[model samples]
Target: MSSLPYLKKLNNAFTIFSRSYAFKSDLKIKWVRPEKIPCFKPEKSGDLQGFSNINKSETILEFQNSKELATADNNVKKLFSLEFAPKKCANNLYIKNMMSKVQRHELDFSTIETKIARWTGIIRALQESMERFPRNIRMKVTLKELIDRRKKHLKYLRRWDYKKFEWLLETLDLVYKPPPNHFHWITRKESLKKLTDKYCDGIKEERLKAYRLTLENEQPAFLEEKIRTLQFIRDEQKACNVVVTVTEEEINDVKNQLEELKKKNAESNNQLN
Candidate 1:
């Protein structure tokens, strides 16, 4: 019978504890949410040609403005051209551009620069596909693997031939983001704690500013009241034929402080105006 009461008390305590520490769905703390990692793929990864490239203005054979069985009408040609071609074609163009100098021949796929360029092209295409179909887990995994592989190749190239590595990066317009020395998973508890501390600090700063303004506003009144009280005390002591504790020097000092404060406040107000 005594044990029943003890168990009931224990259950109640557990309920209270759980409620106290429970995550509040209603509270919208931005820090508690995971940060959206940006796609590291270069913006111009899939570009067919440079803006200033003379060839960019010329049409491909299949899309040339001519009447041929292989070539379609101008509208259809524009639609099916390299500019509007599928992702695969764009990736090929990007890879070709990157490997232009480093590649010995058309079959040179084993080189570090070529491999990086290939992976970079694929990553750019996959990222675009992922944006359209975000739920494709297989594609996401492939993209992540490709990115890691490219990073490894880049690291090797950087150590072996730094000049070539720099040239490759410039050609591809790629930014190499090295892995952190120590990987730290962002946990909700730690993030929320930091956010809470920031919030508290902001409130503390705001309150302090308000208090300071209040003190500044009351300074003149306070000094005036203090001067009156001291003068009255001195007068009363002299009238009663007693030694005055509050001296004339002290009153002069307070008056000087009040004048200085007024001058400072005026200068500040003038500056503000």
Candidate 2:
């Protein structure tokens, strides 16, 4: 009897978010989508026979703490690099120091740092790929990531007592609630969890593949960067190597928010019109 209400909530969340985020052709308003470029996930296998070889949804790994784990759209390296909260070592001062190195090397710090961070995160995801994908061939990689992240999270919480952690969890609900699901089948918590897990593996696999490609390409870029830095080379010509291959997800995110704002403005104007 107690579990029934929880299922009711999950069902509602699924319905609300799904309807709000369903696929469409040439959306009339971009703002309805996202202010932040969300993670991307390839469609399920066999959705399109033309691209049958693409089975990214079946293989990649995702750590336990990742926020985008439930989202339909998932970006590989970026998702792995995504952190819910920044710890002390990851504060603004530390970031500024890191950026100084990029400046000294005459490289755009944003691009350099993004790439290095992504590299680190993917390597981390690979390290923890097993716990994330217990059944996958490369499970050890995920396990390593999980262990490392636990240490990091625990390190971050070192100053806080057990009560603080519990309070943090409680505050989350006040600030965030799962979207409601209109789909009846996803009403149960256990049922929803199982369903998401099956698809999550596939998404993780795709992310892993993308990260691999990115890593393969990173070798030459990093070496070239090292060479130029050592030689004290600083020029726009070095920008090519400096460019990090972050997905252009931020653009759409901005557009989506813009659209939402415009929509509200238009509605207000209509009242005047």
Candidate 3:
């Protein structure tokens, strides 16, 4: 019957121990997965393909200002102006702006730079359209395919003609994001584990710092006790006329160290106050 109480007490103690070590619900360990960065980034200052002047009034097609249109009626001129032009016309202008001097011919659309520029124009237009209709899966798929194609072209250009690749990127204001050498999916379990480890490390470091401060604070008293013990041993040996192991020099050194430690502590305290 006495063992029953003992077993109950032991069980209670085990429960308390388990509760103490259990993960606390209120611990401030927070880990948020970063948003995935897209491979495409158009320039910041202009329309999606970085063509700032594409929408300008003076950027009309050459035919719009030809003698035929110049002599046409006012309504006809307004109808032909860039203000009334379709989005396709604006995209064409953007592509023309991206073309380099070496690839400016009308039929030179197969060059790497030209292909990238063409894809960039289409990609920007699709991106704008997607913004308006985010749930359009068809447009989204097309945009993804175009982005992948452009990335492939960029990769080839970078491998074959690095200088031209750089020039093309600068002209198009496009950033080429190469595929990662290794892909690791971000998971909640892994992130939480990493965060827990980091949090534990911080706690360990803080406790160690507090412990070091405690040892430092006790140094003066410990040194005082050591000095007194050494003095007593020396005095007892001298009175007994025995060989002295604790010399006056050793005692003086301990005293000096203790005095310096006190001075430092006092200065620190004064500073704190």
Candidate 4:
């Protein structure tokens, strides 16, 4: 006998069990309509079209960490001098100093530090180009690549020597913050804010919409409260009328009893006389 018969029986049992208990899983899946999704659509402009050729996002102008560096205004000579080149170092003098720092056996072009220094020079050139032609997408893309390449070089330095990484960051006047290893995708505090912002004109508009809906849904409750209050007032007035009637009838009966007592007193006086 083959094991196929046993396998078939197990499969049938699993199918029956799944059919009977599938609802217990409490899995709810909702299909969203495409129109309900919020998307950013850039305006169609000739200037924006020039950006289509660029795939990378460039960094905006930022403050350098060091006031002295900022005052120097990113002059190429100042940058090379700040990198520990000789005083009043010209471009060729700066390159000669960088070459002297390389090991005897190491290729000048192949060293990591040499590559990093060369990339910095390239980045400064790109930065100047971008400042002149801010809307040029090609220059922006090239600047982005240079910055990215610098970051990779920094990371390699950090992995080999953390102290050197910190020194480089200080010397470059760039901020460095390591990214977190784990990220939470499901829980977001700003989702509601973003959702409302995307769909509504403003917070005031959202509030007005919410208020209108609340008024529409509250009609039944308002009517019920009005009916209850009117009925309560009517009941109170009826109770006052009943109490006044009972009190007046008792007062009239007491007056009649007093008159009868006065008549009895007068007849007793006449009989005694």
The per-prediction CA RMSD against the true structure, in angstroms, equals 7.3, 34.1, 8.1, 23.7
lDDT of 2: 0.42
Query: Over the stretch 6-91, how does candidate 2's per-residue lDDT look in tens digits?
Result: 99999999999898867553423222321432111111110111111222233222343456554535555334332432332133
* Overall lDDT per candidate, in order of appearance: 0.73, 0.42, 0.77, 0.51
Weakest ten-residue segment in model 2 by summed lDDT = 40-49
Cα displacement (angstroms), candidate 2, residue 184, comes to 22
Residue runs of model 1 more than 4 Å from their true location after superposition = 1-32, 35-87, 100-118, 133-139, 156-171, 220-260, 271-273
TM-score between candidate 2 and the true structure: 0.17
- Residues 139-162 of candidate 1: C-alpha lDDT, one tens digit per residue: 887877787888888889899999
Candidate 4 lDDT at 272 equals 100
Worst 10 residues of 4 by lDDT: 38-47
> What lDDT score is found at residue 9 in candidate 4?
100
Q: Could you tell which candidate, 2 or 4, scores higher by lDDT?
A: 4
Residue 8 of candidate 3: its Cα lDDT? 98
Model 3 Cα lDDT, one tens digit per residue, 116-203: 8777777887777676787888877887888888888889899999999988777776677777799999997798888888989999
RMSD, candidate 1, Å: 7.3
lDDT for residue 186 in candidate 1, whole number 0-100: 83
Candidate 3 has a TM-score of 0.61
Candidate 2 segments exceeding 4 Å error? 1-192, 233-273
